[model samples]
Target: MLQVQGVFKSYATPQGPLAVLQGVDLHLEHGSSLALMGESGSGKSTLLHLMAGLDQVDRGTISIAGQRLDQMNEARLANWRRTDIGLVFQQFNLISSLKIDDNLAFQARLAGRFDPLWQAQLIERLGLGDLLKRYPEQLSGGQQQRVAVGRALASKPGLLLADEPTGNLDEATSDEVLQLLLDLLRDSATSLLMVTHSTRVAERLAHKVVLQNGRVADAGER
Candidate 1:
């Protein structure tokens, strides 16, 4: 469902360009899950951004579900992001003013692909049914994060790109929510590429990939 090859990205600093991802290669099949692990300065999140088309690659090709993102212009990329990619950030980028239901369906509505039935189901499954009318700030950190998660999956995009989805939740909440996410993704036939710091969480995924020094240190077999 996804393929990335020979990706090289860099950022400029006072000294010169600081390289983050170099000659990175990745492949993921349909409905499969991949866990990416690495240290603070590693290129895990950078790769995720590239895959989601949130950032441009200096040199590489990113193809998700047979659509090559590297060839898209800004407007096309935005459209692709809205229609094909679902992203979960560590910051849980939920709209502060929008209520739960609206937030969940925001992207879907924008893309003219809103599935009201699926949205309602996601709200209930994420335990946000009772808080549908409430804004994001009205909830606790965990609740907000779950809402963010619901928002991402609500769009029913083919590829799910998550960066530290459980980063802010408690251990128990993390496990519970992740299980829900996994079960939902499995049932919905969505592919996942997640970046995480915990091996315990990584092990739960079908494939584990380690990103070290801008390269693959170890990759688990399918």
Candidate 2:
């Protein structure tokens, strides 16, 4: 469902251009999950951002479901992102002012794909039903992250892009959250591309790929 070919990304530095990703190539099939592993400066997040269309790649192509992200205009990209991609970040980016219910429903409503039955299932499956009345600030980190996952999946997007989704939790909580996420993804048949540093986390996915020197150096089924 996703493909990245010869993707190169760099940023302007005081010294010169700082290349983060060079000639990276990767792919994720439909209803499959792939974990992206790399060191701090190895460009894992950069490639994720390129796939999400949050930033344009300096060169090469990122295609999802046959549409080229690098070729789309900002307006089209924005629309595509809203409808096709679900993003979960390390920070658990939830709206503090909104209650859990509102936050969970926000993205689905925005994408015009809200389904009460599906959302009800998500709330139950994610263990979020009791937290609906609470605000983000009132929840623990794990709880908040669960809410974030619920929000991301509410629209039932084709792909889910997660960047260190369990980075803030303890080991037990992280495992709990990861298991919930995997179960939900399987239920929804959504393709997953997650960036993580933990081998344990990577091993849980269907496939794993390591980024070295800005390219996919190793990749295989777990």
- TM for every model, in the order presented, reads 0.96, 0.99
On residues 10-127, what C-alpha lDDT tens digit does candidate 1 reach at each position?
9999999999998899899999999999998889989998898889889989899898887789999998888888888878899987888899899888877899899878977898
**What are the Cα lDDT values of the candidates?**
0.88, 0.94
113 Cα displacement, candidate 1 (Å): 1.2
lDDT of 2 by residue, 28-100 (tens): 9999999999998999998898899989988899899999987789999989988999999999999999999
Q: Model 2 off-target regions past 4 Å?
A: none
Candidate 1 TM-score, C-alpha based: 0.96
Residue 62 of model 2 has an lDDT of 89
The 10-residue segment of model 2 with minimum total lDDT is 213-222
Q: Residue pairs in steric clash, candidate 2?
A: none
Any idea what lDDT model 1 has? Answer: 0.88
